[model samples]
Structures are given as C-alpha cells and as structure tokens.
Target: MASKESVCDSYLSLKPEKATIIEIIRSLFSSDLENERFIESSEEGKLERKWIILVSVIVQWVFLYIRVPLAKIGDVLQKWLNLISINGGLLMLFLNWLRGKVVEPDSLSSRSVLGNLDTRIELDKSIKPENTRYKAVLSIMAAKLSYENKDLVQSVVNHHWKMKFIGFYNFWNGYQGRDSTQAFLFKDTQSDPNLIVVAFRGTAPFNADAWRIDFDISWCQFNKVGKTHGGFMKALGMQPENRWPLELENDDQHSQFAYYTIRKMLKDLLQEDENAKFILTGHSLGGALAVLFAGVLAMHDCEYAWLLERLEGVYTFGQPRVGDEKFGEFMKEKFRNHDVRYMRYVYNNDLVPRVPFDDKALLFEHFGPTLYYNSCYGGKVLKEEPNKNYFSLRWFIPNRLNAVWELIRSFILPLVKGSEYREGWFMRLWRVAGLVFPGIPDHIPQDYVNLTRLGTLLLPKETPKVQHSE
Candidate 1:
C-alpha cells in the first residue's frame, strides 16, 4: 500500500509535459467517456431511428419517383442532404414560426391573433349548467383554453356547463421574447357562485422563442416589499426592489402592462361584486405568467391586496419552476396562509415543469403541493419527497432524447408502424430538426390534454371532489 501510494504521488507530481497544437485541438473537440455514455443512452437510438428513416426515405423515393435498386440508397441519402443544405437556417426558422403558430379561428376584435394585440374577447351569457363537478370541469376547460383562439374561446365557454362566459382580455406582450397574454374570466356558476377565474395561456409554440430552452434569466424581485426573512436591522431584511428574477416578474418589452391591467380588472371586478371569489389558472407559459400575476397581487406593496385576498385557488398544468429560494419561500408563505389552494398538475414526463434549470444564480424553484396526474397513483396527489427538488446535468441528454422521440412519435413513428398516416419527407425531417434543436414538442399543450383525458376525452360523469379548492 505504501509503495502504491508513493508511485501514485510520483505520477501526479510528474505532469511537467506540454501538448502540441494538434493535441490541444483534439482535447478541446474530442468525445470522451461522458460523451460515450450519452451515445449509449441517446445517440444509439437516434442512429437506429436514422437508419430506419434513411431506408424508408430511399424506398419511398424509389417507389414514387425512380425504380432504383437498393444499392443506390447512398445516392438517395446524399440527394436528401443536398436538399436540406439548400433549405438551410432560414427555412428552419420559418418552419419553427409556422409550428408555433397554432391555427385557430381568429379573435373577433382582432383580425388575426398573432398579428396584433386584442383588447376585447366576445362573450356568451346564455349557458346554464346541470350538476357539474366544478374543478374537474375547470380542468378540462383550462386545457381547452390553451388550444383555441379568442374567437373560438367564447364558444368553449358557451358549451361548458360549469362556468359562465364573463370575458377575455388579450394583451400582446413578452418579458424577454415576444408573446401574447390572455386573462380569461369565467364565472363559476356551478361550484362557487360569483366565482371568477383568470386563466393565462402558456407559450405559443409558434411564438418567438416558443421552442427556446435557454436558461438565461435576469434576476429581479417577487414584489415591491424589501422584506427578507432575516437581516441585520431586523429579522427579515427588506429588498426594496425584491431582488428576485426580472424575466419572471416582467414579460413585456417595456413594462408589466398585463400585470397592472389585470390588477385593475380584478379590483373593479371584486369591487362591483363583493361576493366574488377569484382563482388564477394557466398552463405552460401562461402558468408562469399566472404565478407572476399572483405574485404581483400577493406582494406587500399591492394597494389592492384586499381585492386579491379573495383568491380562492391557483391551478397550473406543467408549470415551470419560477424563482430562487427566497422568492420561493415568499410564495410558500404568501399562498399557504391565504387559504389559497395552489394545485399544480404535472403530466408524465412533461418537460415544461423541469426547466428554467434551477441555478443558485437564477434561483428558479417549483412551488409545490403538485398533483401528479396519469396512471401514477390514478391522478391523485403525489405525496412523495416533500420540500425537496431535483436537478442534475445528467437530465439534458435524456430530455433531448425524449424530445426527439416525441417528434418521431408524432409523425415518423406512425408512418413506420403502418398507421394510417401520410406526410412528406420534408415535414418529417423538419419536425425531427425541431425536436433535436428545441424539444419544445415535449412540452406541447396537446400532450397535457391527452394526459388529463386519461385515454378518453369524455367529460367526467361526476366532478371529482379532489379538484375543489379550500
């Protein structure tokens, strides 16, 4: 043991060698053991998928265009590569823009949804209900909210039995990248009389940076209160600017217009109807916005905090982790004591909830009491691992792999599996590229909807009381 230790020490002390420029270049760019692990975990499957696709593409081309032999597959693959090169970055950008822009009937007040800010949303007050489990009904309604445009939004409300259409307020905004915000108001006629819900939409996959998984953040504050739990002068130190996350606090180009606007609207709403019960709900990006909006209302400096106190609950599907530990502590205390039910629903491996990657510098944290939906516990609350969070550099590769699998599952796999699906090679390749680059498909709103449905879109026969807010 002594001899081995001495030899090891001698080897460690003898590193007085310099590398050639070639060696430096190789060290910088070469794949290592970690890279090998990544290949075993992810790239191998991708390679298998790629070969399957190449053969399929060749067979497809030969059948449709040329009666070429199987030996000519390499030529066909080269030709496809040439075509992709011709299309290049601009084509990918345009395709991304197209994918993110979900096609829905136009908003009534605005000519086109993605084209302008919408000040108004049409309403229908004629709907009435017959024995609906309110929160369960709302769960479905929230999912519907994500897929429709302003024009079709009213139709959904009119069709549901649990809620009455109040109105929707649309604002074109973004904190860092461009996005549109909608504050959907609905009267909970079935469960809580005079109840108002403000549902925010998540990222529009077609919007700017919809697919961007970048963790870049600007630290700001949760509220105007300079109060921290502990400091020198007092037990709780005050952060005048809140010193939270800037990107989470503000999403628009200039100001927090959506926050202030909704604040006023909620104030006026509760003012007119003293019995009004408020709930904030959103999915994906809208879920994050909903948290920010709630934070704005929950902050100490909020003059209209009284108006916000009536907030009955907050329900977010696949919500991203919002702020650092302090901000999270603030949110925990604020929402916990307020008789607010912060019921966050997470679908199986839904990637949105996993992101904004928790960093000490960025300080993104998931506010809990999460409802783990899917066959896991039959859609009941997941009680495991309280007050704990998980984040590791190990997740990136698998997430990318999942993202790619999701795209292939969406389009290519169906074709290979002999499903009644048909799509050209251009689209298949484009979707694959989207998966490889952004993996936004892993977080798409449609998957959440399907997960919530439990293998069927039928409305529940009875409202599951599990959804009711305290």
Candidate 2:
C-alpha cells in the first residue's frame, strides 16, 4: 500500500545494488542474463498459483461439506469448482508470462548487429547509399559545427540533396537547465522564398537536415514555451526550483506562441518572395508543435492563408497528443489535403506515447493512420500493423479504469480509505506465488512492424536502422 511516489523512490534506491548483483549472477550463469525466464519462473507466476490453489481448495472443501442436498447439486458444485481452479491456474500462468517478457534484459547489442549486416541492406532503399554516406559525412560536419559554435546540430538531412543542414541554439530556462528549439529553413539554387520547411526533432538529437535549416534562419531562437510541465511534471513527481515559462498560463498564450513563432519563421523565409509555399515537418514533439503552430497561423488570418492552404505536409514521428479534442479535430480538417502522418514506434512499451495527457482524444483521433512497430520486441522483427482509424473502446476502457484507480489512490483514497492489512497480505501472497510459475515468450506480431514503417514515412526520409545483439 505504499504510494506510487514512494514505490518509485524505493526502486531507484535499490536499483544500483540490484543491478550489480544481477550482473554478477548473470556472468556466472553464462546463459543470456537479460532473459527473464528465471525471474518469471521463480517469482511471479508459480508463486501466485500456489496461494490461489491453497485458498480455493480450502473454500471448496468447506462448501462440499456444508451444501444441502438438491437434484444434481453435488455434480454442479464439482463442475463449478473445476472451472474456478482452471481459471485461477490460467491467470497465474498469464501473469508469469507477462512478467518474464517485460523484465527480460535486451539481449542484442547494437554494435554486434550493425557490424554484421550488409550496410546496403540496412540502409533504407529510398535513401541511396551515396545519399546515406553523404548524410553520415554531413552528420560529422554538423557535429563539428555545433561543437565550434557551442550549439548542438540536432539533425542533418541527405534526402535527395546534400549541403542541407539544420541547427538550434542551446538555451536553458531558469527553471529547466537546457531547452533546445529547432530552426528549419531550406536553401537551394532555385530557392522558393514562399517554400518554408520546419523540421522537428524526435527522441534523440538533431541530424543534418535540422542543422541546415537551423543555420539558414537568422532570427531563430530556442523555443521556450509550449513545453510540457504542469500535468506531466506532476505525474513524474518533478518540481522545478523556479517558475517555468512554459507553465500553462492560459489557452491564448498557447495559441499566441504557436502563431507568432510560425509567422516570424515564414515571414523571414518569404520576405523576398510572397508567392512561395510553406511546409512544416516535425518528428515527435516537433511534429505536434508544427501542427499547433500551423493552426495558430490559420487562426491569425495571415496573408499566407493560401500558403496554409498549400501547406505541403506535417510529418511526425512517435508524436503524442498535443492539444484538446477541438484542436485535434481542427488540425485534421486543416491538414486534410496536406499529408499529416504520425509514426508510433514502440520498443516493447517504451512508455513515452502513453504519457497521461488532458486530451486523450487527440491521440485517439484526428491523427492519420498509426504505424506500430515491434522491432524492439524479442524474436524476429515483423511487418507493421495499422491502428484502427478512431479510438478503440476496448483499449480506452482498461486505460480509463487504471487512470481512475490511480486518481482514487493518490487523491481520494488518502482522505477516506482506511489502511487494511488484508490487502497487503493478499498482495504479498500473490507476489510469492508469481515466483513459482514457468516463463512465457513475448510474441511480436508482424502487423506491428508495418504500422511502425507507416509512422516512419511521416518523418524526414531517415529510417532508424535496427541492429540485433549477438
């Protein structure tokens, strides 16, 4: 019955020692230490079964003796008991399997896997080898440039053209230590002043394209607003030493920031030419910001409403919900003709996409087809699968239940609920039972892989190469 925060703290405190012991044990075992077979078999599954069986047997015996005689009552009672036993056993088995799957260490090392693959095959077919090599070289150059300027080159681009780069200024808010914002502008021989490309960074640092664009923009500064703070920080139990600028003041601020930033970038790019097109591209957080920024510009009645009309696309990778249901619907409507894609890449439940947000519907709806990838899951990487167009009731129901339970525990229950020893007793008993069960394999279906690929398409043409461990 420890609070979630307390539980997290306890886990963190023990992690170092636990990890060290585990490493020692693993080295001695020779077997793949990352595999969770031992823990699944020893901790969660079988342990639960032992307790359930014991309790069930005692209850059944008492019922057997006390039951009054009725036609076929004995037979009916026996059948019911058998069914209960079967279900209890099944539940234990399932829990054990799940634990084993989730707890297992990643067996593959990136170095070993990448070394073995034909670099040609590992490279995306759409990305020519020359292009990949060029990008890699550009990546090295950008890294050097960022190092020289004391700013990070978030990303580089080698898609169809070389010499394209994007960069960002590194600024730290008084509250949060360091905040980075992307500056995306493209320069070609036939530069269409109207054509503006805004590149968003994903989970990692920027590459060549982002660097090129960052370098092109003269007045660009790191984005200090619209960053997730209140709810997200609360969920993570994080508190800043000072007031964060991105802290939600009002809805208008959100809209204004989004509107002003996009307009300024567009005006700077199209100052020379009024008839050029404007395109927005972001991966992950960048994508969500691009969508919001574009929507704000549309609301402002800017002269380039046609550019908004001619909005080429909004490509996002592993993006979460950025706004409320109304905002999401507006985005979908505005970007209907222009490509708006969200790639949902999951490495065995990485837990980023599922971050609790106010407008769950944004993720559930508005976004186009979701590409789900299970490459991070054990076993062979399978083809991707597409999520249903709308929010799934089945998935939502469980999520809601969990959310409510968490809310009650954190907010409501602490006020009214009494501490009960029975709950603790049962939990410990269940944990013990889990220790005895056999481990089960976690299966990654091919459908998930296809979905991930579909999501990847939304990003600039770089495909994250998957390298396996030895």
Candidate 3:
C-alpha cells in the first residue's frame, strides 16, 4: 500500500478517476467526428450519460431530499432502452468485425495500377524515388493477399504469373500452402530479375490474428540484443516512482512474430548474385517486418551480409513504431552511410505511426525522415518534420475494439462466408462500422496505392543518385 501511494505521488496532481470523469464530460460534448469514426463513440457516450445520471440524482436528493420522477419512471426505463440500442449497435459492429471477411484477390488490385511503371523500370537505371516507394506499397499489398485465390492472383496477368512466381511463402498454423505472409518476389516477371522486390505482405483480410499479432504491444528484446540501451536521463523524464510504461522498456522491441516470418526468408533469398539489388517494401504490418528483416540481415555475416549491401532502399506505408530508441538509433546510424534508404510514407490521418507508444515515452522513434504524402497542400511526397508520438484516450479504445474484433474474426468466420458469399453484406457493415469506429482506414493498401499515385506524380523528375561502395 505504501509503495502504491509512493508511485501515485509522482503522477500529475490530477486524480486518476477525476481524469476519466473529465474525459466523460469532454467526450459527451465533443464534435470531433473524424476521431469518432475509429472509436466506439456509443460506448463512450454511455459512460458520459451514467455520470450525468449520478450527478443529477445527487443534486436532487441534496436539494429536495426526494424528487419524484418516480411516477414517470418511464424516463428511467427509456434510458435503459438507449443503452441497449447503443450496446446492441456496437455488438453488431463487433460481430461484423469478427466474422472475418476474406479479401478476394484482384489482379488489377491497386498495385498493378502502377500503370506501365513495372514493365518500364530497369535494374541498370536508377529508379525515381516515387516509383520506388510505389513498388514498396505494391509489395506489402501483395504479401497480405498472397493467400488469395491462386486464380485471383494469376488472374491479374496470365496463367503463367505464379508459375514464374519466385520465393512466395506460406507460413502459419496448418497452412495448406495458403496462409498469412503470402509474400512473393516479383523478379521472375520483372524488367530485371537481378532487381527484385522483397515484398513482405501486410495483414490479410481473413486473419484477425495477423493484425492482432502485428498490433500486440508486448515488446521483447530485438533479435539478440541484450540490454535496453537508453541513458538514465531518458528514463529521468518520468518520475522515478512512475513505473516506466512497459512499452518504454528500452531494449525490448516488437519482435517474435515479424522476426519469425522473416527468418524463414533469409536462407533461401541469400542465393542471389553478388550484384543483385533488393528494394524492400510493404504496407502496415508488412512494413514493420521489412525493417526487422533488413535490420537483422544487416547484422549477419558473409552470405547474408550482402542482403544489406545490395539493399537499394526501403519504402513502407503507415507502419507502426517497431523498436525502442536504440533500435531506431541503431538503424538510423547503421544506414547513415550505407547504400539503403529507409523511408516511411504516410498520408491523410494515419494513426499507426502514433501507436505502440504508451505515454509518449521516447522508446520508439522512426528510422528515416517520413516521406509524407500530402494531398491537402498538393499531391507530393516530401520530407516532413521530426515525429513525436502521443498517447490518447481516443487511440486506446480502438486497440481494445480491434482485439475483440480479432476474436470475432477468428472464431466467427463461418458467418462471413457461406456457400452464398456475403461480400455485399460484409462491405456494407465494414463501411458503416468504419464511419462509426474509424480505425486506420488510411492504413488500407488501396488508399496507400491511390495516395502514392498522386504523390509519385509530384516527385522530382531527376533520378536519385546511388553511392556504391563495392
């Protein structure tokens, strides 16, 4: 109890319960509709209403001793109905979220919308920065959809697409050659096999667990790193009694799952020629994995070392913060003089970049400067200011909603797809729910593709020069 009190002393003088209550009043009146889209506004409203009821009754009892709306207890009953309606709506939304909807593969999926870029760009030539980033977005989208109907994937171009498919993987529990991380190399059909896209896939539409795993905040030490690597002063920012947000445990980065998937790729892909060039790219979860893979490969010896040496650049869309400052600083420093360009592309109101950060601890910082795709000012990809992460009462709610959503998505998938497909229904609920609980809509691969297309057109015409140390 003494220890608890001691720890409590360091917190901002505001009472914790008072803080939540303040949130209630603020939320009840808030008109921020954009934020309302990703959160369960109905649930928050109920908290506000409950507090209002408690306060009103207390005032009545103190002033009159007994106020009789007792005869019109119907009003009290009506409030219950409102509660049911709000909760029921959330429940339905939750159910729809759970009933895991499978993404039907599109050959013409947004990635191929790169128009003639894929068929045109060659290995001998330097790729314009925008086209390189576009390919990264394409890689991530493809990684996520790799498990879609083979016909659907091959359906994009020809019967021969997957036949020439190189290094596509199927890794998961009981994966019958179809599961998450359905990543594949684009070399076989590319302008140059030597210049390949190591597209790690993003979260799949069918697997709630994939997104859940990606979003999980439990940080473990990165790969083989031993100790958390920040100075005492960084920790000094928090009151000593304040238990550091576990997410801020400096050495512990988001590992395990992404590393597991990436480890599967290291051995096979190492067989490429010495001069082979790999452009690493992906969206969302795939983006995080690309960094992990690239970082770990950079630390390797002999054969695998070339993976980093020949790495052309990394382009990711809406990726979350993956590592503590050490990992960020390590990658930042390691790539500082190297040939690789690690860049994260973000657009609109992407929330992923702000997350995995608990209480704004300086634990996780980004690698390179963000290549912000600004559509508001003009459609262009430009370097933005240094990033600072925050913790919001608003952001916390969606993660919980997503967890419940994942549970629903995993077990209730049967409801999503019967012999008569429910694509129409699934889309309707997803669209409606997105309006109510707006979580990461911009994180979607298509949005990334569309936003990137606009930004790419704005990229400077001059090709970025490469410095080859070899």
Query: lDDT tens digits, residues 317-338, model 2?
Result: 3444443344455555555544
TM-score of 2: 0.37
Off by over 4 Å in 2: 1-161, 170-183, 188-196, 202-262, 271-278, 302-304, 337-350, 357-366, 376-470
Tell me, by lDDT, which candidate is best: 1
- The per-model lDDT (C-alpha) reads 0.45, 0.31, 0.42
Candidate 1: worst 10 consecutive residues by lDDT? 7-16
State candidate 1's TM-score. 0.53
Residue 138 lDDT in candidate 1: 62
Model 1, C-alpha of 152: deviation from truth (Å): 1.0
Q: What tens-digit string does per-residue lDDT give for candidate 3 at 1-470?
A: 01111112111111111223445355456654223322222223222223322333233223221113431353344343333333344465456447863232233332221211121111211333245444543454454444344444544323433323454554442111134444555553443435566666665533433443443332323333211211111111212332322222443331213333444344355464544566677667667766766655544422354456667677777777766655676676656646677767675446676655523332455545666643331333333322334244665565445534433442343364332212223233443454444444444543454444334434332223222111
The C-alpha local distance difference test score for the whole of candidate 3 amounts to 0.42
The CA-based lDDT of model 1 is what? Answer: 0.45
